[model samples]
Target: MSPPPAVWVSGLRKAYASHLALAGVDLAIPEGEFFGLLGPNGAGKSTLINILAGMVHRSSGRAEIFGFDVERDFRRSRQMLGVVPQELAYDPFFTVREFLRLQSGYFGLRHNDDWIDELMAELDLADKADANLRSLSGGMKRRVLIAQALVHRPPVVVLDEPTAGVDVELRQGLWRFMRRYNQEGHTVILTTHYLEEAEELCSRIGILQRGRLIALDAKDHLLARFTWRVLTVTFDKDPGPLPETLAGFLSGAGENTLVLRLDQSRHSLGAVLTALQDLPAQILDLHVQEPDLEDAFTDILGNMGLEQP
Candidate 1:
């Protein structure tokens, strides 16, 4: 038999006084999958996450966590989930170790120094365990948030821009740790504006726009939907002239190079090379860049052009 789904939502809806935040959203996240929730600002990414965290009341819909209804089994739902919120909200008076201890206590977990020590060491917070929250850097504080969330070892973990304001080294460390948890059978749901991270880490992705679920599928499938490719042709010297046919495909001409955005289905790379023939300069190099998650994100939201809420 298949393992239970970590999360399930059907016909989910949420509304404010004059606006709807989510409209008939439906999604199911299988256990142990790294899922990405991607969208521009005000695209209902946070709203969906809020509903899952039970921080927001839904107008209509059903949400289940580990087969427990969120509305009816609030305690169980909350117990099975850990959320690292986007914002930094922590008590400055507590030390890093103290904070995790307190958070675990809220879940009725007794003090477990071994677990706390392991978490601190794994998150690189061992040296800072005795330091006050106010004494740590922003990235360190973010680690504290993650440590607090994992104190009870919830089956599902939600990270909302956990890398925001974090340094590159810390970001890499965080991703590696998240991957370890995912491999160990913990479901991870990530929401971020960083598309590159999503492309690199998530196996599946969901794109939201204007409170609507625009796209949801495996990462490769989502990228396959965007077939536009970019070719860069570099010249030893500045090309003094251009072909008339090349003008249509040329996106821009930079210093000693020309960039073309071509639909790969209709025009092949050979065709692009043929169009660049007879230029007044020798070819320095050729580079091809494929569409990434950021490209898909722009294409989707640019198509919607929704007004702000």
Candidate 2:
């Protein structure tokens, strides 16, 4: 039998005065799955995260973490979950080490030095363990936030834009650590506008648009929904005009490059190459871009509320 879901949200609805923040969103995240929540600003990603963290009460519906209802068993449910919110909230006076100890204290843990040191090392913050929170750089502070969330060793971890404003190397390192954690039975749920991160890290993804769950499925299945491919052809010089054969296929045009949206069923790459062979200018470069999570998100926003075939 399949293991029970670590996090289950059903018919989750939330509203603020007249505006709906979440509309009947339902999600089932299996144990050890790396889940992603992708959405643009104002798409209610924060609201959903808050609801799951027990920070914001839902207007209606239910959310459960490890069989503990969020509403009825708020403390227990929260104890099993760790949330690193988008905003960095910390006490400036405390050192990173003390901060983590305080967080561990809240969970009623004593002498968690082994786990705390392990977390510090994994996040590359062991050197700054005794440094005050105010003395650390933004990147270092973010690492502290991550360590604090994991102080209790929660089963489920929710990261809301954790890599924002961080360097590429750190971002890669974070993902690597997350992958190792998930492999070790931790259920990780991430919300990021960085489509590339979602594409690389998540096994399953959900797209939210205008306060609704627009799409949800495995990464491959969701990517398959974006059926169009884009080709960019840059000319050595302005071609002056596109060829007649290429005109109908062109979706956009830049100063020296033309963008074509090709449907595999109707046209092949060979045909496109053939049409551009006789162009006036030399082909400076050719790039074929496949549809990714961002393309799927754009499609979802455009086709929201419609049944996609």
Best TM-score among the predictions, by candidate number: 1
Give candidate 2 regions above 4 Å deviation.
Answer: 235-245, 254-256, 278-284, 305-309
Model 1: clashing residue pairs? Answer: none
Tens-place lDDT per residue, model 2, 1-309, is 665589999999999997999998988998889999988788888999899898899999889999898879988999999998788778987998998998899999989999999999999999999999999998888888889889999999999999999999999999998889889999999999788999999999988876788789999998876667899999988877767777888899998988998886678889889878777888989999998887777777766653322
Q: Model 2 has how many clashing residue pairs?
A: 0
lDDT of each residue in 7-34, candidate 1, tens digit only: 9999999999988889989999999999
